[model samples]
Every structure is written in C-alpha cells, then in structure tokens.
Target: MVGDEGRLVGGRYRLVALIGQGGMGRVWRGVDETLNRQVAVKEVLLPDGLPPGDRAQLVRRTLREAEVAAKLGHPGIITVHDVVRDADVPWIVMEYVSGPSLAGLVAQEGRLPWRRVAAIGAQMADALAHAHAAGVVHRDLKPDNVLVQDRRTIITDFGIARVLDGSAGTRLTRTGAVVGTPQFMPPEQIEGGDAAASGDLWSLGATLYAAVEGNVPFDAPSLMPLFHAILAKPLPPPRHAGELGPLLEELLAKDPGKRPTAAALAVRLTALHHPPTLRDPQPPAPPRQIHQRSTVTAPAQPPNAVHPPTRPAASARRRPSTSAAPGGPSRRTLLLAGATVAIGATGGWWAWKSDTKDDAIRAGTSLPGHTKNVYALAYSPNGKSLASASEDNTVRLWNVTAPDGDAEPAELTGLFWALAFSPDGRTLAGGGADGTIHLWNAADRRLVGTLKGHKEQVSSLAFSPDGKTLASGGLDASLRLWSPADRKLLARLDGHDSNVAAVAFGPDGKTLASGSWDNSVRLWSVAGRKSVARFSHANYVSSVAFGPDGGTLASGCWDNSVNLWSVTGREKTATLDGHTSVVRAVAFSPDGRTLASAAEDETVRLWDPVEQNGIAVLSDHSGALCSLAFSPDGKTLASADKAVRLWDLDRQLPAP
Candidate 1:
C-alpha cells in the first residue's frame, strides 16, 4: 500500500494525499505530527525478491544519503529533513515545495520560448553548481526533479538516488535503473559508469532542450534502441531550439568530456535570457558541401563605393522573417542589376557558393595565460570565469568571455596543488605545498582565511556540496574535514597507509574516497568517520573520483592503468590500459559514458569504461600533462602541461 491516506509514517508524517508515483517510489503530501507542518514524504518500495544483504545495504545507503542531503543549504535545492523506516520501507521527509515540476509546465504549455527556457536553465545550472560545490550530485536530474516556484526553478529529490544504484541488480527497474530518466540520460549513464557532477549537468541540458524543443534529444519507445541511439546516433539538430542548438549539441555529445561545465552553461544560458529572440517558425537550411575549386571573393567596395540593396535567397522566401526582424521584411528599394546578381551568379546560374569550411583547429584559439607550467585549472560556478594555478606561485583568474585577455591574478606565497571554487563563485580554495589551504574572495582577489591541519603538503581539496565543509588530503596519509565557516577542523580521516594523493566525495557527501601511494583507494563514511571499503590498485593511485551515481569509483594509477571499481562490492570491475606513462588524472564524463585519462605520455584518451574499449585519444598537448578536466557540459576538455590545451571535443573528435 503506497501513500495510504490517514496512515502515519514513523508516528510523525501523516499521509494526507498521494501526490506522485513512479516505478520505485511514491510521494505523498503529508503533515508532520510533531512539527505541525506540511511535508512531502517519499516512500521507497523495495522489491520483495531482494536478498537480506542487498536490502540492508540499500537501507543504510538511503539513511546516509538523507543525512547528507539535509545539509545542502541552497535556495534552489530541495531540503530533506529526515529519513524514517516504516513498514519495512524507508520514508524520506522533504520540505513541501509548492509548485508544479518543469515537466508539468512543458506538458501544459507546449514548447517554451528559448528565452524562458534559458532563464530556467541558468537557474537550474546555478543550483547544480551549488549542489556540486557542496559535494552532492543529484544523479537523477530530470524535469520531474525540477520544480518551478514563484517563477524560479528549484531542484528537488536532492540525494535519494542511492536506492536505485543499490537495487540495480534486481528490484529497481522495469528495465535497468539508469540512475535517471532514460530520455534525458547521457550515454555514459546507460553505459554503466557512475554519473558524476557532469552527468547532472548533461541531464539539465537535456531538460532545457526538451523545454524548448518539445521532446527529449533521444526519444525511443524501448530501452535497447534508446540505449543505442544515445550511444551511437548523432544528435539531431533541434528544430525549434535555434540559438540553443549548439549548446544542446555540445551537451548531448556521446563523449562526456566534451560537455560544458555547469558554470559555463549557466553563463551561456544567462546570456540568452536578457532579451528573448524567438527564431522565425521555419526549418533551417541544411549545410551544402562545396568544392574547393569554387571561387569565393569579397564584394567590391572601394574607398567610397556604394552598393545597392540585394534580394533575399530563393529558399528564404518561404519565411520572410529570415531576411528581416519580427517587425516585417525590410522595404528597401533595390537596383535591379545588383539584385539579379545577388541571387544568381556562379556555376552556370546555380546559387553563388563557396568551398566547405573545415571545422578544424585554427591558430590563436589556445589561451596562453600562465608563465610557467600550469598545474591546475577550475571554472567558476557561473562559467564566466576561469582560475589557473601555475608553478610560478600565481593563481590567475581569466574572464573566459574573452579568453584571449587576462584578468587580475592573485599572488600566492607557495605553489598550489589543487584549486576549487565555491558553488556561488564568491570564494576560492587553494591547497598548497606549505601544508595549508587558503581561501580567497573571488570578486576582489583578497585573502580571506587559511586552514591549517595537515602535517605535509596538501595534495587535494574539495568543498562539500553545501559549501559549509572543506575536505583536504595531504602527503601525511590523512584526510581532514574542515568547516570553512567556523575555521575549525571537523574531523580527521586516517586510513591510507601512505601519502594521500587525491580525495573525492560522493554526490550525497556520505562517502569520501581517498587514493594513496600505498596502492589502494579507500571509501570512508563521512558521518561515521570510518573506512567502509578498500579497493586495491596495482600501483600507487594518483586520482580517485565517484561516478555521478555514486555507485562506481574510477582511479588512476602509476602502473599506467585506470581502474573502475564497484563501490558496493569494493571490487575492481575493469582496468583500462593504454597510456604508455603513469596515469596522473582520471575523470568520468558528466554522463558516465566516457572515461577520460591523462598521463605523462603526453596524451589523453577517452574510453568506454564499461566495454573496456578505447574511444578517441586527444594528443593536442605539447608536453607531458599534469592534469585534465572536462567542462560541465562535456563539450570541451582542458589539459594542463606546459600550458592549458582546450580541446573542442565536438570539432576535434571523429564522428561516431
């Protein structure tokens, strides 16, 4: 029985009405008996066939997730208050948000204007940046998880995705539990890599695309063909998306590393929102291939030469708006001679043409902002800014809106190993060789605070999803959690046998993973302060990251291999071997479909981790690379070595 009216859950939440229902759970509008306040309760219905151990694991994971989700303090994010066990199932008590979901709005209103969609998308991206900064990844970010209140978008169901990840074997799916709605899911999610922050961004992009285009990027009736389409099919250009088409194409890239980051996407979306420009209701012209032999010349216009008005293209006549603004077609008087030549010229009267332009890399695209070797690079949450840390003891923030120019740079006393921005983009955190982590005001480049707890050089730093806690791993083989707000050490996680090189928190902030020179990756329960599982690597592990779904962990090692592990069993699932030198960084694309590995071999390779097959290899860097990062949308990949090499994945990678 789901959401039975009048039934009380955990002797507190009394069901008043059933609000929604899905394959795994049902939501109810209820009243908290103890607090006398309205609340939304999600009841998870576990499949009866689950074994005792699996059931227990799912329950434990849910409880842990609920606790972490309660900490996410963001206006755009839904609030989870409690997790209670009732009638052998878990009931998640969430703040009752009063509004219809974005999906519902789309269904009722049809396709939204691009401007409206952009505004909504920008807000969604801002929420995601907040959740990510707090170390929380909303694995199932779909239209249903997004609620519109007072014209503002709010993301709900903050961190309850673990139930599906744990039950993927039997109970969680009519098909397979893909960590999200299949229509909006990235190819990575279907391919079996855990969804990462990038995954959430991908789903958000898909949602925005659907809002404006009236359907998902990939629409199929069944699972098998839909999976194929998501993996192999080219993204059909959005007919109604117009200016948003390019952004959607980048977001829907089969390669996760090619997608834009949430910050970058937010910036783009905000730019689209200020003034709405709806595309004229007409199909776009297909790209016509032209021969290289065709002559293309600039029209003559000497010192004071004046030209007469020209007629519109033949096909463009169907939609007059194509030649003019919404007001109406321009009524300029034209000279017949000039008008005749404008519509007809080369190829024996075939429309005037030019050779097909190659979409290849050109000179001056790369930004050379650092003097010495660049060690780290991070995009601000809103995506308008970029911060690059160099070996020259300087952290430079670049206004990426104009990548060619440099903004003011911040001078640090020591070389920094890690750099991360707060969710709001107001604060910056930098970990240094001096065994201390420094915080700075992003706006003014002013020093704010310094956290000191590590006895050795800090190797990595991550801010929790709520931006309240900062986690740092050091060469001393310990992970310390600090409260940046209080300037106090919260807890010290000691389990690694050797120097800790990397640290990453799961989307829900329940698990903190650390990689060490001891050749192991250890997962620790954040609240319990204990190591939950240990995964072994052949050599020293250099980087560790939890997939967006928080079910899988990817680690890069000195043995020139990247390994994927199941977080539940703590077992190695696959070893990706291709790089000739030590693998320094490993990242799962936002959707979890593509795994990107960077190494000292001077190349970065994208792999289908589930299939254990290599995809594309990025070899644009000039020297051995030290780090690699995917933009939130996965459309662009940034690799740092002697300098930062930004690969436009859409144009750089071969067609599927």
Candidate 2:
C-alpha cells in the first residue's frame, strides 16, 4: 500500500521500505527521528486462516511479553529496543541486522558445511542460553529466527511463540493456533504444552538438522501428519551432521526430560564447534572471550537443565576446585563480587559465596513430573505440601510429608512466576504472567478466586504472617496489596522503575521488602502502604527474602551474587558470591540459620548467615535455578526446574 511506505508509526518511526513479509509478520527497514538511527520495525501481522475471533488483544499482550526479551542481552541475540501498538497493530523496534536470516541463507546456499553448521549452531546455542537464563523461553527457534551478520549469529522475535500460544496446552491443537513451525515443533509442543524451554532445545536440534542435512528431522505434507511424525516417528539420522550428530540426536529426544538443558546445549554446541586439542582437561576459553560468562559461555543455560556441566567435558582450564566438589559435580570459576560479599559453602546452609573454599553442599535427588521449566517453588506453611510452578502452566503439588510420595498436578490458567502459601495452609496463591493471582483451595486444589491489579505478570507474591493481607510485585513495576478474603485490591504501591521481581513480608508481617530490575530493593510499611527505605543491589535483583528474626534480608541478583542486608541498619552486611550465573532464588531455612540460594549455575548453595561464611554448594539440577523454599521443619530445601528437587539437609554432607 502507498500509505504504508513512508508512513509514520508510533509517531516517530517512518517505514521507509519493506524488508520482508511472512505469515507471522512484516519486517520494515525504518528510520527513528527521535534516536536518529536506522531500525528494523516488525509489524506483527496475524497470519491468515484463523478462527474468526478478535486477536488484536493477543497482539498487544504478546508485544508486551516481547518486552521480556529486552532483558536478553547476549551479543548473539538481536536487541529489542521497543514494542509499541499503533492503530491496533503491534510494531517491534529492533537492532537492524544487515545479514540474511538463517532460513534465507540456507535456502540460497542449499546445504551448509558441517563446520559452518557447527559454528552457527554454537552461536545459536549461546543466544538461547542467554534467553533461558533470563527465564525467557524462545518458544519459536528456527532458521528464520536466526540472523547471520557476518561472522556473528543473532536470534530475533522472542516472546512470539509464548504470546502466540496465548492459551493453555493442547487447546492450540484444537484451535490450530499452535505456537511454532510444524516441522520444528517438539513433541511436547505438538501435544499442547505451554512455552517449555526444553522444547526450544528440541527445535534448535531440528533447525540444525535442517541446516546441515538440508531438511528437518521430521516432515509431512500436512499439519496432522507432521505432528504425528513428530510424535510417533523417530528423528531420521542426519547425513551431514558430522560430529554434531550425537548432540543433535540428544536434542531431538522423544522425552523432554532426556534433553540437554538450556546450559548444556550451549556448552555442547561450543565444545563441538571448537574441539579441544589440548591435553589439558580444561578447554582454554574458546579463542574468543565471548564464551566465558555463560556456563562455558553456552549463553547462561536453562534453569533446570538436568546438569549445567559448567564446562565442556573436553574444554581447557580448570577452575579452582570448590573444595566441596573436588570429586563431585563441576562448578565454574567464581566471579569477584561487588562488596561485603563472600562466596562458597561448607557444612550446612544455603548462600552463594565468592571465595573458593573447602565448604560445599552435596547433590540431592530429583522429583520428576513437569515437562517444562520450573520458575517458582514454595512450601505450604504447615510444610506437608510443596508447590512448583512451571511455564507448562501447571503447578505440581508435592507431598513433602512423605517426601517420596506421588505429586498431584494442579492446573493453572496461565504461567506463574511465583507461588506462596497461606499462613494457615488453607489456600495457595499463584502469581502468573497474565498478571492475575489465582487462589486455590489448599486441600482440593480447586480455583476459588482470581485477584487482578498488576499491569504485567506477577513476578512475586507474599502472605503476611497473620495471613490477612497479600502483597504482590510485577513486571509492571507495580506493588499491590490484596485481601484474599474479599478478593479486592487494598492498595497499589509504586516506586520501582522496572520489573519488581520479588516481594517478601518481614518476620512480623509489618514490613514488605521488594526487589526489582531497577537495581534496588525497597522496604515498605505494609499497613501504611508507604515506602519506608531503599537498599541498593549490586545489579538487577531477582529475589528478596526475610530471615526468621526479621533483622536481616537477603537479595539475589543477576550479578551472580547475593547480598544480605541488616534490616535495622538498612545497609549491606555481607555480599556472598559462588555461582557463575545469575542468582534467581534465595531462601531462609526454617530457623534462618541456613540461607540457601539457587542460581543459573544450577547449584543450590547453603550459607551460614550468622557467620557470613560459605557453607556448602548443592549441585544437582541442570539448567538455571529459579526458586528455593525450605520445608517447615527445615529438613528439606526445595528447588525446581523440570523436576522439583528436595534436598535432604540432614543427610547432606560436606563435599570431599
């Protein structure tokens, strides 16, 4: 249309030329008058042949969800500058890449060389790792989403699959609104699972399978047959996968649980692309320094990767043995923390310390069930039950009383980032991406009511000690108080400039402390709904929790470190660092004697909060660690990914 060319969108963006158009959306190379920069604008055009219903709302929300991609900062990933809706059409502003899409490149060049495929796959893995660590699942991972800018590979259009699926699993199959490409969709996805990050790894494998073999692992002329082939049929062996074949096969496993997690995929890809020739066990950081921050630079792997191997089994250089893990699970090198922080752990306790020491926690057993990433874990007040929430949009209610007993899956309307139990254990609260708090009857797991107020996904939730008032913080940067009794909003507390990632009620329930992406934790007076004080974090804070005594508060951050603050002093008492990845969840043991922390490193560390020294590192998970909770008796520490792990603290021994 003549009106489209040279048209202004969101006031300042002038669409100069159409770069491309597809079933998903249209890409336009445009100019930003305000920023004085050239930009690529993606006008998300809903595909044709859909049920005749209003999808405009879906577009807007999906665009907002894409904002979560802005948090993905890896160089291999395209930068999402802004997402806006103009005239009911959503436009995403991103860094303009001059290179062709992987799909375009592969189409024009037929089949890629094994080395080329390895190189591209490695970069793609790195990008995916970053997304996974940030808790953003690139629901759609395919050749078209990969952009090759010279030697650099970048992934784009994140949050699309998540936003597209909109509804809970399997229903997409009924509505024919499935999230990803047919050939690239994982079995879990075809069957109607929500945005499971493991499914992305599967898609990555298929994308690589197509890049080298010149065809996807599975295909059919129609959608039903294609899904059937994906489900019942096995992945055809690759003809040109070269050394990458084994990894590809692993990624395409029929079982999602059997796949390499977000962190492992990147490490495996990098290890294959750059095979270690040195006799040394440690693979010298790849010739390029870019692959160091993520687990072996895999891009900060997933939160529940069966094991974030920390290093390529064949890579060069050995990090100092976290004295605790000399013969145990591998731990990456520790980064120096900001200030007043220490790293490592020893006898018993959970805390991320920076120093390399003999103290470390031992590995624990995995409780299996969920097929996707677990984002939040919470123990019921009475401690008999545990709740784990995942992107799969289901919360697994584990019977902690038996610890080995079967779990009951509680269906959710949407994905929740945080879970909290009522003080009396009569109700369970789920904070979800849809920005609603779903309350369920504790015993039967039946939905009782939905509390709404936050503008974006609820990132964290907390119930007062008295169980009268509930506090919530979200990506909308809004902190809200609600009375579950009446399902009404009591007040909205506003101060944070970015996503409020965590909320916690003080021991007395008189104060609420919230952590945010703005790099600060604000303490508010619960009843007054007024900001009482502010504590600065070394980096974007992901979690905040109060000690049993309420005299101290712990804040976990993206900086791969944890800071404990003295509640009275409102100042940092100690900084602990040990994990190589972002610290996602921090919890206090029932007695508050042991402070536990989980990070992207896939290890849960115990810290002696009183001594401010390292206790022990618990290594058992695969991808990044998101949430941690302690059983009422403090004998068990719970963390989630695909399976919820219950660390038997009493049986746990210091690493050799």
Pick by TM-score: which candidate is best?
2
lDDT of each: 0.69, 0.73
lDDT of 2 by residue, 193-217 (tens): 6658788989988998999999888
Summarize candidate 1's per-residue lDDT along 555-655 as a digit string, tens digits. Answer: 88866667778788667776655565667788876777667888766677766655555554554454656677766766556677756655544323222
Measured by lDDT, the strongest candidate is 2
Error of 1 at 108 (Å): 0.6
Residue 335 of candidate 1: its Cα lDDT?
A: 31
